[model samples]
Target: MIASYEMKHQVPYYECDATGHQTLAMLFRLLILASEDHSDALGVGTAKIKEYDGGWVIINYAGDVDRLPRENETVTIKTYVEAYNRFFVVRTFEVYDADGKQLVKVKGMFAFMNLTTRKVASIPEPLIVPYQSEESRRLPKVARPQLMANDLAWERLDYRVRFFDIDLNNHVNNAVYFDWLLDPLGGEFLRHHRLVNLKMKYDHEVRAGEKVDSQFIKIEEKNQIITHHQIQCQGKIAAEAEFEWKLV
Candidate 1:
């Protein structure tokens, strides 16, 4: 059986929103940190992977959030290898509140990439050997999210990718995408709506100094709301996302 890794964190004020709830960006940052720690423990940290000319890139995130932890709440973060193929690995993450209640669950799909060529590459044995996850030729795919209706009016905002947006590997990190995706929604809309489900896919990497156009459309249904977002750079989509929210 594949063993899981766990870490604990105390939600600090900076990671929380003005209302004292954990921000979605910070929640994901916590997951990424936990995963990195897991890799360090497994002996194949970033430096080790670079020895094989490979870099881990997360391409998809599918998840649901029960609630965001409040500021100062202690939470447990855990992740385990779910499955893998010749080219991809899926890892599952969960966060539990102080009372042990599940607060968030996410499945992240990762691809081993050639850092030089910036292309997806075959999984290296040294990398897969440690996980011991079930190997499959065909892994289930995340559903294609409901698309935004182009006929309807949409809101857009533009951001210049700053140097800080790039990670050590010189690629845009995950947190900046959240800022681009949700910033178009005015505070009045965001403060009253709570995200419940989300599906996001990263298709292209946005580098430093690039201009990104973020577009979002809101669809309202009975007591629930759905938002479709597209992050495009130079007319090519860098990321696509769909989020479900409920009015509080």
Candidate 2:
């Protein structure tokens, strides 16, 4: 029985960037691994998801990193179920330093989807039972993106379409957008506060050869920062989004 699994991990050198800190993309990957571990513990790993003719697909995710894990540092990821809606489940992650202090917190919304049909499906009862926890509480109210905000404006950020960014979906991978957004801020912000939250709204498809603009709106009262990405052809908002970043 994988009761309350724990694993120690040393940050790999390759996962670090020029600043000698773990890359945002790599951090996301680590969290994915932790989630898989949780599935294994509950005996509902990916194979079981497939067995039910259903699979888990990330619909939306918001996370905040408080500090960047340096090279060779051992960090622990503790995760648990926060809540579940009819079509979506909210999972949370807490990353800790070797000393056990919290470093990063991630919350994601996942949908049970029919792989073949590529559509949302009702979560199976057996699947949900094991994942549920008596201590699991309702997730905190998150500030969602506003499709239209008067204070928000789009700033064009041009990215050359790269062959590698295209995933099996034939579109830019969702995680790649984080690189685009976080890279602009440089490693300073990432190195400072651990990411406590990140909200991403994929408004439209990003294809090769298309230039895009990322927009931002500051909502300090809520300790939240919002951003948008748009595909610009002749300077029009083809796609738009707002993201909330909460400080840990």
Candidate 3:
């Protein structure tokens, strides 16, 4: 059996931002879809997870984008299980253009959680064995995003958890967090810049009817702009992210 899986996709207009290129959030969504496809091929996908009453949750994700796919462009996404421990699995992804030039590289860490308790659970052997991934004492890790200081003058926006934002898991979908994080930057900034690198840590989940406050602080370094974001629910942090953007 092949250790990796790949899929071809055409960049859709709805997935692109004002810059006419795929948004960072859409890239993340695509990576997730690819992972789901891989898991389904291995016989351990959504249906199996439901049978186990467990779901996979991303603990952290980090990626670097060399180029963003433009609207209507055809691209390929390749993904594989990099490594796994007793509690967490590490997966990696690469996006390539039609010419085979890589556009993005991504790494994600995920843990299985029991739906009832919402706590980490041991991965089933049957599920783990199918991936044929390496078992390691130390799996790859992404740095946790730091909290934005209260003293910093940060821009903030509030969003209600809409029905559309909820996924099958019944919580705000992880991909929606990217919109909450970047939309506060406004169209002007997004039009003039492109996301180059991003790292995010999900600390808490936002449920429907909850109001989430998205805040961020921008730091200019050399030719790049780095932004730190914090999403809070009821004054408690739900997620944190760090983004690096380059001038267009």
Q: List runs of model 3 lying over 4 Å from the truth.
A: none
Per-residue C-alpha lDDT of model 3 across residues 1-248, encoded as one tens digit per residue: 43899999999899987678997778888999999999999899989987888989999998888989999999999999899988899899999999999999988999999988989999877787888888889887766676668899989999999999998778999999999999999999988887888899999999999999999999997776899999999889899999889888
Over 4 Å off in model 1, which ranges?
149-151
Arrange candidates by lDDT, descending. Answer: 3, 1, 2
lDDT of 1 by residue, 1-248 (tens): 88689999999899987667988888888899999899889998888998989988888898898888899999999998888899999889999987899999989899999988989999888887777678877876654456666667878999998888898767788878988898898788888888899898888889887999999988888877899999889889898999999886
What is the TM-score of candidate 3? 0.96
All candidates' lDDT scores? 0.87, 0.66, 0.90
Residue 206 of candidate 1: its Cα lDDT?
90
Model 3 residue 115 lDDT score? 85
TM-score of 2: 0.73
Model 1 TM-score (2 dp): 0.95
Clashes of each: 0, 15, 0
Q: Write the number of the candidate with greater TM-score, choosing between 1 and 3.
A: 3
**How does residue 233 of candidate 1 score in lDDT?**
94
